[model samples]
Target: MVEIISIYNYVMRRILLIQGLIGLSLYDEIGQGYLNEIDLECYITDIIPTLAQVSNHLHPSFERFYVCTVVKKVFFFLDHLHTRRIRIKDIVSSGLLSQLLELRDSAKSRDLVVNETGNWFSMPAVLEVYENYLDLDRDHDGMLSKKELSQYGSGSLSPIFLDRAFEVCRTYNGEMDYKTFLDFYFAMEYRKTLSAMHYIFRILDINQQGYLTAQTLRYFFDGIEEGIKAVKTVK
Candidate 1:
């Protein structure tokens, strides 16, 4: 039964890819067969109104923010290397475009759509992520300083972890852009993915080496211990 289910899902995914390609073909119309950031932004903006019809969770006032957040997510995942553009093939293969298209179906309940926390294109999920970013940007600077980001998620992440994130991940001066923050968020939230693991490993590999050594592990472990002690002291 498991094998059958796997095969069925494979077929359905292929069909979804084909459907996504047909729907998105016009966006890559110059025969470039890809979408640069501006092209993708326009495409997503055009579809937002249709998506809004079924997205009772999204507010009219927040549609612009929602669109910007979703576009950033697509680039973060599908472009993977921050390339500023993506091939339609990659978009279709990632199934994100298909997932966005699926939201157009009025048949899907608002509860079901909003609860798909793992789906990047989910309206409620994107809004939640955007809100979190806004809350963290206390300075209204549109970017997160180390002090601002340290307050993320109960403030429990080790100082060393954040230090390495700023060191290894792309940042503007000493602050992290929303896109880079999304990368950090994804690494922490979906640690099982290869990309996420690689990101985490990069931060942990303090010497810029390709692999983690026992010394590296010990260094972070010590940082974690100190963080725990500090948290306990506060209580």
Candidate 2:
């Protein structure tokens, strides 16, 4: 027997979700029916005590890192304008807030608690990303230089590719900050997704003329060619 849910039920469920999120927005303080970074951070922090029930491995000191990472991820996907605030409508439509709230009673399974289908609120996922950044940072600095990032993903990425990344990505003193690194990490990890593909496309479209040219392809490919020669020499 198929348990079919009617359209009316689906609409009612959506309405309830929006209502709940609007109530959560009371934390906005400015009367803006949106959650700013601080608001989101505070909300997540409040839930951490309950979330700990399912996340036994979470250390006390890691709370700050967890909150910051989750908030950044939410905004990265939902804050389309990079405004640092997510409107209730956007939050409801994305269903991200509901997924986040579910952490309060999520199952205790390691795999479920960790990745949870790439959930932003997953403790293990956030920790893994932070740990990866720490490993690559090498200097103990809170930023990654092009040389450090070169050590990423088999360490075979081309110099011209790195140049284009640095040219396009947000950096300070020629280094990538954690927030910026998150963007780079996702673009690489989910390269097949439209958003990630668009990001990579921007990097490839070096001229920023809104399109990719064969000359640009050759320019980056030259670096890959050189890399192959170097590997052959090593062998």
Candidate 3:
């Protein structure tokens, strides 16, 4: 159900969210700058249209870095919103932050934490990852197939090695959900020290793995070398 709210309330809610959620204060650099010659309220009013236009509008720089702290603050708030299932689409049309406050108000009424959706997701980090997966899932079938997963490899990672990684994931369970997707993805990308390395080892085990064969090691190094090149290029 769409909640029709007053415009004044909407403006005030935006102000509050700016202060409380995004953690921005008119007394700070952002309030003093970027919003040149205008008061904080007026600045927000001007950007209300832009805010309404973009859902993942957090941390916007327009290529400038001075106000990046403000950007991070905004993303932190957006992540908080996402965790509560209050997607950006739900409230951007209300002129601004009123939707966020509206969700806050609903939670207050139900004696819950900004959600009546019942039972907060157990894994918030995974939920954030799932949101990324949704972006990756072009078909939107609620499952990621090999083609969808391959988008991460832009001719840098060895396609054959990726297939083997997929095999290692499939060995555990064929059905792909957020959980196994994390298992697969973190193993390939996150690079944290854990069982994900075991998955890598399993991939290297070609023909009973040939004692970490030269070809298998090269496949892994190819991805690493490409990643280093990309980072250096960025630098």
Winner by TM-score = 2
C-alpha lDDT of residue 104 in model 3: 37
Q: By lDDT, is 2 or 3 better?
A: 2
Best by lDDT: 1
For each candidate, how many residue pairs have backbone atoms clashing (under 3 Å)? 0, 0, 2
What value does the lDDT take at residue 148 in candidate 1?
Answer: 93
Q: Indicate the TM-score of model 1.
A: 0.77
lDDT of 3 by residue, 1-70 (tens): 2345577766776676655434323323534222221232343433433332221232343212212222
Candidate 1: C-alpha lDDT:
0.78
**What value does the lDDT take at residue 95 in candidate 2?**
78
Pairs with backbone N, CA or C atoms under 3 Å apart (clashes), candidate 2: none
Give the winner by TM-score: 1 or 2. 2
- Tens digits of per-residue lDDT for model 2, 1-235: 2335577767767776775576567678987688898888887777676664334667878778777787777776776445668886777678777666555554544446444446566666787888889999999888999999999887889988998899988999999998788878877876776657777888899878988788988888898999889889999
Residue 114 miss distance in model 2 (angstroms): 6.2
Candidate 2: 10-residue stretch with minimal lDDT: 108-117
Cα lDDT for residue 169, candidate 2: 86
Report the C-alpha lDDT of model 1 over 1-235, residue by residue, as the tens digit: 9999999988977786686687677777687788987788878877776663335566767766767777776776676555678888888777688778777756564356445666567776876787788999999999999999999987878999899889988899899988778778877777887767777887898998788889999999999999999989999
Q: Give the clashing pairs for model 1.
A: none
Taking all chains together, the TM-score of candidate 2 against the true structure is 0.78
Better of 2 and 3 by TM-score: 2
Q: For model 2, what is the C-alpha lDDT against the true structure?
A: 0.77
- Model 3, residue 201: distance off in Å is 1.3
